[model samples]
Target: MRFALFSDIHGNLTALRAVAAAIDRAGPLEAVVVAGDLVQGGPRPRETWEYLIEHGWTLLRGNEDEALGADRIIHGEYPPRFRAAAVAQITWTRKMLGGEVLQRLTGLRESFRVATPAGDLLVVHSSPRGTNDRRGGQHNSAREVVDGYAGTGAAVIAFGHFHSNFVRATAFGLLVNVASVGLPLDGQPIANFTLATATSDGWIIEQRQVPYDRGDELAAAARNEMPPWPASEATS
Candidate 1:
């Protein structure tokens, strides 16, 4: 069976649509899992949430989702510059999302697990420990990354939060960072995802980068006068 995994939509409906089209073109997929951060950066927060809900995609709550639901980011501290921008954008997103959408966002799960022939696949926004885990978003050291998998009990852990993509074999299991769909920070303005195909030997995973019109999203950001840092400079 083949499963398509993506995350960090961040309200870029264009990227979301492009990635979905690419997944459909790839043919039959057993399931589609969205690891989260569905809104609060790009232009269309409400639209992005509606589209995902309409499709009934499996969901995971990202930090942004939690912040949006709470109407404030809860981190103890963040770099001053980035924290200010994050607060502005998330506050805007919460107001833009209003009632029903915010409720739905609050209801999203923090993690999920699926049993595959190759192994138990655990999906989370950042790591198995949960969405609020700050260390899950960093690869500061190999030891730290490996330690994040403690008690997961899954051979494959698929996640997206750092906006970077990588697949690595660790002492715990195979860790797959599916990356971001809307705001990739890998110096590449492309939509990213991961396809996991269960084989007789094991689970074969493929990371995919689908090209979309970055200009459109950028223009929308410009027109809306969104924060110009972070996502815009991510590809630089």
Candidate 2:
């Protein structure tokens, strides 16, 4: 079976569209899975959310997704971690999404598991432990990362949050980080996703990157009064 996995599309509809087009060109995917951070930072929050909903892809909730339903600002949960600007953006995003959409966002699963002929595939926003684990698959050692998913029975584990795409093969299985579809921090101004295929021996993972016009996204941010887009990385 072949499937597409993408994540961290922080409301950049242009990037999402570009990635979707790339995936379409690849064709005949059995499933499309989004590992979350669906909306929150970029301009077109509602439209991005709508686009994902329209596709009916399997979605997982990231930490940013959790913030949509959190009363952080109301409870004075800003400062050290969340800044004033981030809070403002979240407030604006919530307003743009409204109650119904926010409810749906809140209803997303934290993690998803798919059983394939090869083995079980696990997808999550951060790591198998939880959505807030930002370290994910990148920071940890190969063995450490593989060992973290010890009893999950997943032959392949995929995730996105750090916005850095990579694939690691350990004695246990493959740990793939599909990376960001919107705000990529790997110094490449392109959207990214992973295509995984199951085989009798193991899973074949490919990291696909698609270049898109950033002009529209930047213009949208400016029109929405959003803060300047980061040159390298923003707190996701």
Candidate 3:
């Protein structure tokens, strides 16, 4: 069966909607899975949550997703600049989300596994082991990527969080990164997703990039005046 695998939607309703429309056009998809970081990027934190819930997305909790429910981001002895940004965004995210939505975010797990026509498929925000792991996002290597899911007993693995993209074949099976539906590595930023399934010949995967009402999303972000970082080619 075909499934739409998407991740890191980050509150850009335009991007999400574009991808959703694309999926509708491309279907008959059997299921849908979102790896996470579902909100706290563009604007409309609550709206994004509601939309996803209404659409019944199979969800995984991202780092930002978890931090939104916390009292504050955990400041360790040492953290990088980007991590500090994550903390600030998450702190703001907690404020943006309502109690019920925050609680729902809190309830999300780091990963999930299911038996699909394509054998066993695993979904996680980053990797099967560490939610914050960026090990695989760098090299674009399958063996390296699958290393994170080594003991998970899953044949196919899908995840996001690097805002990058890669598809690889490993000893276990196929490793696919759904790319980011909001932020992206090409520096282009528009949203993208992946379709993965098993085939008699082998496993096949496809990447899809969809267009949306960027001007509207930007207008909302500008109105909110949230997050210090200005919009860039890769982010909005």
Q: What is the lDDT of residue 132 in candidate 3?
A: 71
lDDT, candidate 2, 1-236, per-residue tens: 99999999998898899999999999899899999889878888999999999988998898888888893443243465546676777788888899999999989998888899899999988788877664445668755665465567788889887788998776666778998988888545589999999988878898999988877876777787666333213312
Sorting all predicted structures by TM-score, with the top scorer first, yields 1, 2, 3
Q: In terms of TM-score, which candidate is strongest?
A: 1
- lDDT (10s digit) by residue, model 1, range 104-214: 898988887888888888899988776756455445577677667766779888898878888878777888889898888764668998999987799999999898777
Quote the lDDT for 198 in model 3: 64
Candidate 3 per-residue lDDT, tens place, 1-236, comes to 67889998888887888888888898687689999888856576777888899998788888767667675554241255556555566666667786878998878878777776558878888887767776567574656665676777777788888776677666766667888987776646478999877665556788888766567776776787656432233455
**Global lDDT scores for all candidate models:** 0.81, 0.81, 0.74
Off by over 4 Å in 2: 73-82, 142-147, 227-236
lDDT of 2 at 134: 45
